[model samples]
Target: MKILIVSYYPLGFGGAEVSMKILASGLKKLGHEIIFASTGHYEGYKNYKLRNYRKIPFFFLRDNLLGNELIKIINKERIDIIHSNGYYTSLAVLKAAKKTGIKSVVHFRDYALACVKSTCLDSSNKEHERDTYRHIFVEYFPLRWIWEFYKWSYIKRSWKKIKQFDLVISNSNPVKEKLKSLGIESTYLANPVDLEERTKTSVKELRKEYKIKEFTILYAGTLEEHKGIYELLVTLKDFLIKNKVRFIIAGKGSSYFKILKYILENTIINAKMIGMKQHEEIMRLYKLSDLIVVPSIWKEPLPRTILEAMQNNKPVLATNVGGNIDLIKDEYNGYLIKNNEWEQRIKELMKNKSLREKLGRNGRKLLEEKHDLKKISKELEGMYKKILIKN
Candidate 1:
């Protein structure tokens, strides 16, 4: 199978990038010919070079112009299957596949199609409201609005073209449900994690490096508000003052600055904002922490960080939303707190080291059973074969 994988961003960071790198590499390992196309270079793919397409201003390019370039790529590559990662990139593949008569598969990694804001929830995460807006409004909206309108138009104009694609793949049940609500049927495929690399960290060394004298809580991912970084910081601040614990945040984002600001203003003592580190370094942090916190306010499709933490035999303390509910078994593998009770929950976990160890063991078992990269990759490969046969 000659597969053409397309993504809008570099593949070194973010959930989408990690997934694509795993899929492309896995496919290659399975004796499939894979060609890559993406917007930028990723540090992870330093050895494997990708063919670069002429960079076009995403906001300024009209629909037809974008479609034409994509069509040319499909025809030129003689691509057998077009696997697109993001929304805009998927649209381009859909357009190109139609013109070139190629089969296409779209991976709906987020809730971009259903919600106007694309986070799968209203600004408040309560109910659908018409005037709801995205958090990064200046960076996304107006352009996003235009893109949304264009997508609608393109779907109407090329309904057959768009629908001819073999399948729509989603990472979680919540994401698939959202797609179904939008009249798009999708298959659920769990994202893959590099379990081999994750399992190599020495827990003893990690604990010594972080100076973890007491129970440590870890949060690894973007510090964005949507990810509930502020909530984690607040919870850590309160939890630490009451209990013997420390919080280590390993990742950087817009909310990193906000967290720094909060730390400075309030003189937060227990929480440490270590900023972004490489993937290997992050794994080491995961090893050090006794528990991992995923306090996302939004309904994340499937957080890769959660999977990573679990794979490292670290217990998770996550908000009960999105695929977190799917991954976590309350009081069994990890503690699932209500969105509002994050701080109180952290404090409870801090006081119970036995519970933390139990949950960590359970989480590791679950990761080995379900979230293993090779296992998930084989499942995805089966799905790809099924889609190709159907098409």
Candidate 2:
């Protein structure tokens, strides 16, 4: 079947973009024709760039124009199904698909609707323990609430559009359950990774290239405050100063300077902040890492970093929240612990090479068995076919 894959951002470097490219390729290999379109940035399969919704002042105009653009493309390309991967694009794409009388399905990759920040964290960067509405005005007052009120209104209006799609997909069970709570039925489709794709850079070469001379623990993601980088550093600073381990942070964000200053001022944690690397470079870094720590304080729908670590046979110590629990079976494959356990888990993993290897192998097994692109592609194709037939 010919498919039009829509996304908010065009050709990009984010995990979702990279994974979508991989997924598109997998679908193409299965004899499905794929045309990729985005709002901006890079290109995709027969890539088309939709108009910038942000530039449009009025909401109805944006939706109608985007939907018209999609309708024209669908008619011209004779597309069978529309698979949208983001909120902005999905909103417009669903409207277009409904008008065109074609199959449409959307993938919800993050919890953007739940919170204004989309991290599902409060003002203090802590996860919301209670109902979001109960704490919204009480916590985020004065400034943040105005923007949040606007966002809440936006989501409330557009959310009903989701029901128009033939199917909805969530990348993790937590996200699927969240969608279910909002009265939208969704399928649990975990993100996919290519198992056979080898990185151009090797561990030995990466070590030499990056000057890795000690035991390394890698954290590859945005350097945002809510990512738990600051918390991780503070929690492990005392342990880091005493150990020979090198903590390599491979990403940049608003917290870049903040994190760097702390590393420079402390002067003894042996933690180095290497600004963002391309996806290919990150895969090589994965091979260089002895262990990866995804210490996100927010409810991550599903972090691709942990999936990458699994693909590279690296054990992980991710926070116990959201999809982290789904991928990690506690002591089986990796440890899903809190900040209090970070230092302990790091220390234990650092000391025991055999245990690390054992856990890493288990993670690799899990990745190959469940997260492989080939396997996931088949399942995706089945979903497309089912929706097409059912309609």
For each candidate in the order shown, give its overall lDDT on alpha carbons: 0.71, 0.83
Any residue pairs clashing in model 2, and if so which?
11-42
Q: Quick one: best TM-score, which candidate?
A: 2
1-391 per-residue lDDT for model 1 (tens digits): 7777777676445877777777677677777777667666544332223343345434225445655766666677677888888665666677777778777888888776655456745445553412223433433557576665554344334334445568888888988887676567878887776666654646777677667777777888877768988866775665566666677887878778888888778766777788877666777888878778888888877888888887777788788888899899998888788756766666666777787778888987887787677887788788778867773
> Scored by Cα lDDT, where does model 2 land?
0.83
TM-scores, in order shown?
0.83, 0.93
Q: What RMSD value applies to candidate 2?
A: 2.2
Cα deviation in Å at residue 119, candidate 2?
A: 2.5
Cα-based lDDT at residue 36, candidate 1: 68
Question: Between which residue pairs do clashes occur in model 1?
Answer: none
What is the clash count for each candidate, in the order shown? 0, 1
Q: Per-residue lDDT of 182-291 in model 2, one digit per residue for the tens? A: 77888988799888887767779889988887889999998888788888898888788988989989988898988888888888558987788888778899998899
